[model samples]
Each structure stands twice: as structure tokens, then as C-alpha cells.
Target: MRFSVHSVSLWLCAIPFLSLVGAQQYVLHHLFDHTNFFDEFSFFSEPDPTRGVQRYVSAFEANAVDLAGFANDAVFLGVDYTTPGPWRRSVRVTSNTAYDSGLFIADIAHMPTSSCGVWPAFWMFGPQWPYDGEIDIIEGVNTQDKNKVTLHTGPGCSITNEGTVASTTLKETNCNAGDAYLGCTQATASNDNYGDGFNDIGGGVYAIQWTDEHISVWFFPRGRIPDNVESDSPDPSAWGPALARFNGGEECHLPDHFKKQSLVFNIALCGEWAGRVWGDNAECSALAPTCDEWVADNPDAFAEAYWLINSVRIFQAHEA
Candidate 1:
């Protein structure tokens, strides 16, 4: 279902009247493509916040090692697959722009495949950690077959997936970032929405609509993308049921929790989440004695651990 990057327009003209609510027009605000991805995103060379056994490199280092660049006219972010060491080299980037509310659309041609010790995510978070809220749009650990959309807030915030697809299961209701930070989570049912299955189908588009009232996420697999989306005018109301929807009524005011968020993409190895649950997964555990040990030794096994992003577009809603 995935079309070549050439077929999709890199520049999306602002659509003045794509409505999500009465008189609210969604207009194109930002576009991230191969031509400007490297410039717009800052390479994070800091120590892994998740304590993953992966070294995030600078833009210069990433480019020198072929860990981050452009491929097939798409933005490529990859990991070190040939070097055997305690920590594998990888790339993590965060957008320079931060947004409070908008519709985000990511057209991806490929993503890191499911593998033991590998954790890949495309998420957004505010500057002040849980206090400002975090949104996990596409995330999973280890060999997970499905994607999990989660929200993390400081306290006094809980959400319900009232309008999500039937196959999506709400795992937690409490979004309070307690000591463990087990945020509210929704598990998707489709295998094709994540990991190896996702890559096999030529990847897809992941859309997120965030507003004061609620936040919703949708996945349009390859050829199944709505005509409106391809045409630069997205109407979530006409996109049918979302894959995951977090309702923020009086119970949980979204604006109070989620604030200006920066988009992030990264791949980590043997991280807290993936490493902690390594023993529970029979397939992953059999590969080595421990997650870190396995990730350190098996360099070739992660050949497919990379992201091929066609483009990312942001649309902001304005009163018509």
C-alpha cells in the first residue's frame, strides 16, 4: 500500500478549511521531509534517559558512521549493526519546534523491526517531563507484535479510551506518573501496525489529533490511507473510528496536563522496558543470557533496526 516518496508531495499547501469541529479549520503548519529533516531536528547526544545500552551520537558522528542520513529520498535513522560492544551506536532526534495542539501525520516507509533488546519509539513530550505530559504515539518494547499508545502525566490525570477501535484494549486508566511511571496505555490489536509486520507491508501513516478536549491516534496502512489525507486535507471525523482515543472531559483536562511537546524518534537497545521483561519473552530469552549481553554480541541481528520516514506534516486548527 505504501507509495514511493516521489509520489507524495514534499510541500503541503495549507488547506484553509479542513474542519474537525464546527468552524475550526485545520491548516498545514509544518512539514518535515528529507530536505529539511536534519536541519529541523537536533541530534540528542545525551546519555539515554531510559538507561538503554545504546550510545546516542551527535549529528556529525551519526553521519560519519552511516547511522543517520537520507535513503531512497526518505529520512533514515539507523543503529550500529556491525560494531560489537557494550553499547551500540544509535541516533535520537527531537524536533526544534514544540506544539501544544495540532494534527500530526507521519508517512513512514519502514521502522525498526521487532527484535530482542531493541526498543523503538516515535513519541512526543513536554519539557518538564511528566508534569507537562507525554504522548507515546508509536511505541513497543522487545519482540512486541502490536503497538501501544500511552500517556504519562504528573498527577491528577486519568483517561479512558471511549471511542477507540474495538480491537484496541485499554490496559490502564491511571495516567499519574507514580514511582513506576506506569502510564495509561492502550494496546492495539493489529500486527501490521508495528514492527516487522509493519515493515513488511511497506509501512504506513500514523496520525494524531491533539486538542484541549481529547487526543486520538489513527493508523492508515499503506494503500488504505484516506483520499483526504493524500490530498493535504485531513478530516478525522470522516476517518471512521480511531485506533486509540483518550477522552479528556471534566475528569481529565488535557490542556492542564499536556503542553507544548517536541516530537522525538529513537531506537535503543536493552533499555529499561525491554531489558526488564526480557526473561518473560521465551523467544528473546533463548537468544542470550541477558538483554545487554545479547545486544552486545549480535550485531548482524539488528540489520533491520532503522527508520525510513517519508515525511511528517503538522496541521494546526484555527477558527474559520
Candidate 2:
């Protein structure tokens, strides 16, 4: 019943070794929630990097303007719909730490709806723009019903849609960021995968697995999230085909293109993509002469634009 001091020390030493073994089978590295989300992320206050008709606010300003806060035990990232603007106020937060490869899972209850002039995204990007890499896990603009998963990288990077679902269309193969910024994109046909439809059913879980060979994204609407993911033993191989899968193939290299990437989330109004395509959308163009004018004048239209996130979990692959 009584163990010697040396024996106890030996057992304590073994504890760490045993834990290391367990950690080798995929362990949860980070858990981001309302309480610690701020500590892990920093609000961006610079001009809209993409020249969108939106102003990124500081943490102090976000709290003051009610753009970012905790509501119902969930972290809320919202845009100011009350303020008409040359500058529409919104929050853009970037993770303080960067990761090379991991399984990133986000449990979202709500996201900004797909409305005219509104472009919202949850993405990851490395420094130096296209040369490093950018992965748009969830991105869409201006009345789009489904999500667009894309990647932007320097030349020599290309992807193939070998493992994606049939309904998903590969828009481009080259991941290079040319003058148009069209990157390799995949369009999902699922009505409930993004925007108003996603929010209507209550937002769901989006999981991104980044590895040396390829990057894959999967979406699980509300009650459909896999048990393996819920339990932290995520096995992407068992998740069926991804909604979007970008394989480096021979022309591109994953490790060379994708470097340390920081997770980012933001909402913008009427810039390059949305503004350029505004005229093509009959419904949106009917509302106003242009995207900027409509967004500036119709503040009340975006009252429902906000993100309600439950948590984000990052897991690293381990070998058992």
C-alpha cells in the first residue's frame, strides 16, 4: 500500500512517457472558446487589405461598437449594420499563432448571410500573399448560396479535383494568383453549405485537414458532425470524399507553397470580386446602381450579418 519516494518518482517519470504515447494518436493541441479566443487572436485595424468598402476595427473599438462579443456562451463577430458608410464597420481577427499542418475544426452556430454587397470568409493565409499560400476554407460573395473553397499560391502550384464530391465543380486548376486573383477554386452545389441556407439550418462544423500531400475540407451540417471528430480522434480517411480537395500533384508542391498560415475571419462589402460582378446579378443590381452605393445606403439590410461560433479545435496528427 505504501510506495517508496524513489519508486513514486520513477512512476511519475513514466507518466509523461505514457502520455506521449497517447499524444502520438492525434491529440487536441488547442481549444478556442469565448473566454480565451481573444488571447489567441488579435484584432486587425488596418485598411481593408483587399480594398473592400469596410473598415477593420480594433479590439477596443469592436467592444465599444458591439461588433465583437460573447453571446449565449458563443463568440460573436458582427458587422455594424446601423452605421451607413463610406466605411462599414466590421471585425477582422487573425490568430496570433501560425500552423504548418493540422486538423482545424470549427463549430459555428451562425454566419453572415449571403446578401448583396457582402463578402464574408473564414480562411487561412501565409505571409507574402500568393507566394506563400492562401486557403479559403469558406468564402463567398454577393447572394451566393453555396460555399467556394479556393487556394492561391505562387506559380508552379496547381491542384486536381481527384477526391472531391461529384456535385463540387473545380473552377480552376492553377493556384497561382494572376492579375484576376482567380486562384484554384471549387464551387459546392450544396444549398446548405454556406450563407443564409447554412444559417437557416443552424451553422455546422467545417473541418480542414492540411498535410504535406494535399489539403481537404469537409462540411457536416449541424447534427451530422462525425463522432470521431467530436471525440477528438478525427480520421479524415473515413470521412468519405471531401467537399473540396486540392492535391498538389506533380506541378505543385504542398510543403513548398503552403507555409505557416494564420486563421482569419472577416466580412467586407463591395470590393473587387463583389463589385466587379455586381452588374451580372440581376436581383442585386436591381436594388441599386452599384454595390458600394447599396451597401452605404441600406444599413438596416445587414442587421442579420454576424458570426456565432461555438468553438475551434486544432489537432495534430500523431503516430501510435
Candidate 3:
């Protein structure tokens, strides 16, 4: 996206004039405000690739079901709650353009709650599945109280969570093609980071900084967002330790694994993750014999299945 010099000048004037030494400054590259959200993104009108019990609809269908619209100055993405569907109706949107490296920040007021058969995510992926890599930034499945951040790449790519917080646990170490399906996952300890606990606290901001050296994720509750973020000059160095960090040096090369990836946001129902673990979840398992059965029968259970996004901003590293 090309920004006029006037826009850049305005941003520079809004923030401090000087740049920090030994630190990188990110400039506002793309600002996806609620007003032009639908126009900026394209609806993914196809079957769920994961074979989930979901039917992705077009923008027109989403409008008809009141699934996608602006609510209270924020963008609302929701699923069909009242309709009795053999496959639940939902919406998936992909950004018009792709990015290589940048600081991606999402200001959310509410996200899909951790229900019995819901799988929601705000993630990114390349055209090539494992070859180009995928990043699951804010993702989790059924009845999960905490957020699970993961990375999926082709053969030879791996990461080490050496700089992550103590509360974050590494579920797997090798991020190769074998592990790509499941990938290298790190689960955040805070319940407030995702699901029902997150919504109860009025939601917050999730920032992801991707560079050649490392990929890091940080979560800030509603009132605790960094001042620099609001000023459009985010400095990840001052954000303390990230909740999850993937430092890829000699073990894996980032440019080889990650490429031009389009930003995506969607809520899938009873798919690979949610359906596979259905019987294990006592609360969810008690509702039906299978995940698909429960989702088809109880449509009202997903009344809280929606995303209330205030904004999504992308920042590119300012050249020195």
C-alpha cells in the first residue's frame, strides 16, 4: 500500500521527531479502519479446507445473515446463530495484499468465546501450505481458556522459545514438515489471553513483530496497551519479554520458510482440532456423540461466536 508524503508527515508530526539509537522504528504502513473493512478485504467463499462443519458464505450472504457489518464503530464478524444448519454458516476474509515482514497489531473488543465446537483464529499463511509457512498468532480450540501460539513450516525449519516468558510452555521443539501439521506450539499461561476470560475483561491488543531474526507475540489487556502503540511508533524492545518468541538462527531460516502471506480471520466449527479432541472434553462430549452432531443440533450455543475488531494496523520498519 502506498501512502502519500502528507500522510507520513502527519504521522511524524503526531509522534516524537527523533528516532531512537540502536532501535528500529516502525511507521504506519496500512490502517484498516472499520469504515473500509469490507472494501479492503475479500470474502473467502469456499469450503473449509480442514473439513470443518462450516459453510463459508459470500459478502452478500454474510450481510443477509447479519454476520458481517460495523457495530459501534467497530467491525463485526459473526456466524449464523439462529439458523438450523446441517453445516453452520460463517465468514472468512483474506486481506487484498500480502506482506513479508512487519509489525501487525489487532485491537479487539471481543473474540469468539471458547465454546464446545468453535475454532477461531487471527492468523497468516502463504499460497503454499507448508512450503511458504503459516503463523497462528491468536488461535485456540474448544473449551480452551488460554491462547495457543504456533508456527507451521516446511522441512528444515525449526524454532527455539529461548526468550519467551516462563509462563509460556513449549509444546514441541522441532518445527519441521513432520511437525508442521501439528507444528511447534507454545501455550500461554494466562486465561485472560483468550476465550471467555478475555471477553470478560473487555478484550485487548495483540501485537506480532516479525523480522528475519525472530518472531514474537505480545498480548495486552484493554487498559494496559503501550503508549508507543497508540502513537504509531511501536518499539518492541520496550515491550518487555514476549509471551511467545521463536528465535530462528542457525536451526532454521525464516525467509525460506515464510514468504508473502495474506492476513486471515475466521471462525471454523468442529474441524480437525476441535473434532479430534471432542471426546476428551467432558463438558463438550456430554452434549453429543460427535462434534458435528452437537453443532448441527444446537445453533444457539454459538450466540457469542463473533469478532468485534476495533482496528487492524500494520507497521513497516522505517529505513535508517
lDDT (0 to 1) per candidate: 0.87, 0.84, 0.85
Question: 2 or 3, which is superior by lDDT?
Answer: 3
Per lDDT, the best of the predicted structures is 1
TM of each candidate vs. truth: 0.93, 0.92, 0.92
Which structure among the candidates has the greatest TM-score?
1
lDDT per residue, candidate 1, 1-320, as tens digits?
Answer: 13222322233344244435557667788888887787788999999989999999998888877888777989888889889878899989999999999999999999999988899999999999888999999998888989999999987787878889999999988888453278999999999999999998999999999989889999999988888876566778888888999999777899999998999999988878999999999999999989999989989888888999999999988776
Give RMSD to native, each candidate: 3.8, 9.3, 6.1
Predicted structure 1: clash tally: 1
Report how far residue 145 has shifted in candidate 2, in Å: 0.2
- Which residue pairs in candidate 3 have backbone atoms (N, alpha carbon, C) closer than 3 angstroms, thus clashing? none
**Which stretches in model 2 have alpha-carbon errors above 4 Å?**
1-24, 177-180
Ranking by lDDT: 1, 3, 2
